[model samples]
Target: MLSLSGLALFAGIASAYVVSNGTTCYLYPESQIHLGRNVDDTPSIHQAFDQCGTNGTVVFTEETFHLNTVVNTTGLLNCLVELKGELLFSTNVPYWLSHSISVGLQNQSTAWLFGGTNVTFLGQGGSINGNGQTWYDENQNHSNQPGRPITITFSNSTNLWIENLRIIQQQFWATFVTYSHNVTMKDVYVNGTSNSRWNTVNTDGSDTWNSRDILMENWTVVTGDDCIAAKGNTTNLHVKNVTCYGGAGMTIGSVGQYPNSPDYDENIVFEQVRTIDTFNGAYIKTWQGETAGVSSNGDAGGGGSGLIRNITFKDFDMINCSLPLQITQCIYTEDAGACETSKSRYIEDIHFENITATSRYNIAASL
Candidate 1:
């Protein structure tokens, strides 16, 4: 149920300090901020999480920390951030389209709404930099541009621990976890590239909605979209040794899209994956209950129902991937006989074990 407007957007308190016990707040970067002139270290990083954020330890030793405002810093507990510096964000985009921070999903937005509990984000080799080439040249026609933020959001809170992070140029979807549970993202290092042909579209590399016991391992994504996405009410998700170059692989659900809302993805798992040119090394997308609209990345939805059960895609290794296995209940349907006469939203125990693929096309499993 989460979503009391996503817990009131992670509450308040932007300044104050006192709590101690191994405390260690050491941030700094607004002495007339440098490197292309940027300032506003977001209120001294919310006053260093109001000084050591609880059980203490918030060191971001400034190599660059611009962030033109908005960084919720929710109810932290046994906190510790130590990202040796480099946050950056801020191509301004209309003051982040009037101050970002919306976790209600789909109409996504976030410039960091990081939550509470036993949190720990240690990017020893720090980096966030969502300078996303001016939102990929103003979303070069891939639409869905409502204040494009999503470069940091691990909502509500739990026993979270994001390690060795380095999500680059991401103006959208580089990490989004909702409500939160025992989250654990390891050695992350995403790179949503684009040198002005304008197509770092939807750059997803770690996405989970409504969340549960999540755990993404040793990632190394170079995105375009979904290197990892278990959307909808995702439950015990666990992705292992990931490595995708071009995205859209290892996904589950564009999801049952809101026909009176009832979607629940269960025990999901993608293990030891590796896709190079990717389009799909393992993907699944639903949407065709009573139909709906908008999705060429504009992301609207359909008549969602629910239940995508115990899923698993193990040991995949696709090189020239185009579709090493894909599923679609006719997402955003354009009359495939009216999406085969509608009503489809319960994908059961899906599993694909030692899959080894090499395809650029010529149909490699597309259902």
Candidate 2:
């Protein structure tokens, strides 16, 4: 078993020495490679990955790299991605819409896909810029354009580590981990806001789906959506030492959608979490039974079943949070009478311990 402390030490050492040791491929600013202002560096970035993917490191030094096209780093192995520079995705909505990879999850797509086994992304205080202002404005105006792409995605991966990264201005969910296992995300920061007059929607910090054995710690997240959300088929998940501001707080599910498909989430834990100006502190939400046409994205719903068990939320503090603790079987529906009439998923062995909270509203717990 790899210890967290040992992983941290290795990350520190790798960030410092990998470039100098010739195991690193430095992304140099070359005119031919399109490495400067208004230039698309996608080809050069792919070249670096091809040259130094396995058993090596790809280092982005303290400069700006622009990406107008999608970069797919799937199936990478035994590699470290050191981002000490700004990775700015293009704000050109039409180009991204035509180029991004559509994963078909509630209209979620990604500008970049980072996956495969034994990969480490050490940001070292670097930033991943999504340049989401244009997307926000476009969505506010059109509302039917191709959905904005997520910042980063880990799909079908194992033994992944992401640390010390600042993800900014996400178009959609900041980071998404799906169909993966043995993942650790520590000391990460995410910030997103509406640059236009409209409010940004669905900018979750990080969300896990169909994954297991994940650990997230020491995160500072400010978004318009959930700080961290576990969606479906997630088990043995642990989250700790997280601070959330101006978002919906830590959440388990808006699960039980997609009828005839069964989902389960078990052995989840959240500890040492703090929330300020957040909407809710700890939440578990599920869609009521046999519902259809219930998604904001106009996706069909219903025919999903699930069991959420052995969930724990402990050592949490909330200030000015609207709903400190909320557990509801009905989500996306305001009709309590209809909810009571419908069948919902089962939730068992749920525990909350040592929670200190003050709600902006007089109500503290909504269950």
Candidate 3:
């Protein structure tokens, strides 16, 4: 278990709230709170949040809490969440698909929507299990399956700290921070894979969108999609000391999706990354041209403009990874002639430094 007690030393420097001397509220499995082994704990959790929203700490003790309903803990102010137990989301795919909160960006939905100012989530070697095997199987067979909910999302929030969490089997992206600033995620583990037959798809480890002044470090991710991805309108981001296995590598954009929307990502840096048996490492991908309708992943968009600048990837060690370095201006398009004629986004002032890798495929760099 990673202890966050050391964070107290740097709390002042980092501008993070430390509840060392604050009120402590413990949440339990109680019938009165509608929290039990089988009962939904969403209400109880919210009640705790209400009680300990400011200058306090909420602790989830070592027990299994079943969440059959969506829990939105947005607008939390100066609180600490200590997770020392398993937080399991129910496998009722249809129920969640219909009931989850619509996040309104790229058709994303979430089971847990956490927002607001100066919030900290410290998982004391605990797990947030999404129970995603059913969703993966359903998507494999049903071509028109409903959008699966994201495991956890932080949106429209600021000054957040998330550390030492074991997040597994996410139905969609594991941790998504968007439209926020001054966030830090460290010592986090994310895994979405199958030992049996079903395959997880689009289980990105962490995604940042329209956010700035973010830092992600000391992460271990084994997923089907990008380990860490920076999407449009992101700036002043830094990522380091991340180990990725069986996923798409660290990426910027799949941007330029919404037509006429100006996207910008700048001053981003990824350093000290280690990749094993992954797809791509240190990549930048963008869409091209104006055309769309029910695109891949049941989404639709095109002809968005963007500017990517002052980005750097350094100190990467790739072992048996495919496409160690890739920069593509044309993605999700088949018409070569159209791509040639389309007005693509601007990409400039990019740097790749101290990258050492062994490619599983024969190709080294793709541009």
> How well does each candidate superpose onto the true structure, as a TM-score?
0.34, 0.89, 0.90
User: Tens-digit lDDT track for model 2 on 128-165?
Assistant: 99987777777773322455788899998999999898
lDDT of 1 by residue, 97-175 (tens): 7789888876888888888999899898779889888988887837558878888888888999988899898888888
> After superposition, which runs of candidate 3 have C-alpha atoms over 4 Å from their true positions?
1-22, 30-37, 141-146, 341-344
Least well predicted 10-residue stretch by lDDT in candidate 2: 12-21
- Which 10-residue window in model 3 sums to the lowest lDDT? 12-21
Residue 299 shift from truth in candidate 1, angstroms: 12
RMSD of 1: 18.3
lDDT for model 1? 0.82
* Candidate rank order under lDDT: 3, 2, 1
TM-score: model 3 vs. ground truth? 0.90
